[model samples]
Target chain A: MNIGILLKEGPYNHQASDTAYKFAEAAIKKGHTIDAVFFYNDGVNNSTGNMEPPQDDRHIGNRWVGLCQKNNVKMMVCIAAAKRRGINDDVLIDCGEITGLGNLTDIAIRNDRLVTFGD
Target chain B: MEEFDDDEIVKKIMHVMRNAPHGTIYTYEGLEMILIMAAYDQDISVAFVDDGVYALKKGQDTAGIEVKGFAKTFLALDGYDVEKLYVDQVSLEERGLTEDDLVVDVEVISSAEIGKMMTEQDVVIQH
Candidate 1:
């Protein structure tokens, strides 16, 4: 199955990012394809590469990048939503690509399921 | 509210509105999404709850704020064939508003009714 995950909350403040990551990992382990992980609203903050949490904490941003690299999944941040939150290409993670709503529509149409994780 | 069967071919996509407009981009962008989905002709429904009920209040003057006022866009949603706007009755009453205060016509139903409708959707996108 091809799944499109929409993460609509920011990191740390909510468990949405953690939940999305676990779900994606589990789906990939089950041999399901994660067609795309689209970030909207505050969720676009996950694309920021400059996050500096405590050394003991998990590098949430890098985790998303690693997931995309390992699974060859598209990590998309809604350009409009990102812009509103001051997240741009300069700050986006290595695997993150800024996209539009049309791409989300395509993901929803092409994928067998569209699951969203939000606060 | 339209009913669907177990074998229905139509995809039910519900756009959830949970925040106030202008203060944050969620409601505005959610509306943008619904507009695009309107062209897709999918079965779409929007539920306004919590602080989201403020998006439909009448006589919103944003001249001081300088942002583009989009409350009027709710009035045009019907033209896009994106009807089925559900407003939570508890949210409205708690906010001291009634159907007459909203800019557009919406079915003010209980949260229980809306919750049941949510479980029936193929996809629920919250903003």
Candidate 2:
């Protein structure tokens, strides 16, 4: 199955991003192809390159980057939502790219399932 | 935006609003996303459940609260060709609201019917 994920909350403050990451990892392990992970609302915070978490805690942003890299999945952040929360190309993680909602529409159309993880 | 190919599939995308307006940015930003996707010519629908039904309540005034009220935006959705709107009947009655109190005309149906409809959708986005 080809699945797309929509994450709508930030890291640490909410479990949304963590759940989305874990879901993606599990999906890939189950032999399903992850189409993309599209970030909207506070979800864009998951793509920030400036996050510096403690040594013991999970690094949410880097986790997403690593997952996308290992699995060849696209990570997208809504440009409108990203700008509203101060997320831009300069601050974006290497695996994530800022895009318009049209990409989300395409993801919905192209994937077998478009799952949302949010508040 | 580029035109969709004739052979392209038109997915049924439903945006479920479960939060009240103004208390959070979910409903407002969700509306913004709906407007953008509307132009893509997909099969789109909006469902108002729980506190989401309050987003369409008539006579909303955000003047004193300083937040720009977008209750009227629901009415403008028709202009974008997003005409399929559903309101949960139980949610409406629970909140002491009726179809007459909403800013737009929506199909007031039971949550079960909406749940069945949701199962048929290719994508369901809730805010």
Number of the top-ranking candidate, with lDDT as the measure: 2
In model 1, pairs of residues that clash are: none
Give the per-residue lDDT of model 1 (tens digit) for A13-81: 999999999999999999999999999878999999999999999999999999989899899999988
Instruction: List candidate 1 segments past 4 Å from native.
Output: B1-10, B64-67
For every prediction, compared with the true complex, DockQ reads 0.50, 0.87
TM-score of 1: 0.86
TM-score of every candidate = 0.86, 0.96
What stretches of model 2 exceed 4 Å from their correct place? B1-6
Q: Note the Cα lDDT for every prediction shown.
A: 0.90, 0.93
Tens-digit per-residue lDDT, A1-119, candidate 2? 99999999999999989899899999999999999999999998999999999999999989988988899899999999999999899999989999999999999888889989998
Report the lDDT tens digits of candidate 1 across residue range B17-115. 989887877798889888877876678899999999999999999899898889999999999998899999999999999999999999999999999
Docking class of 1: medium
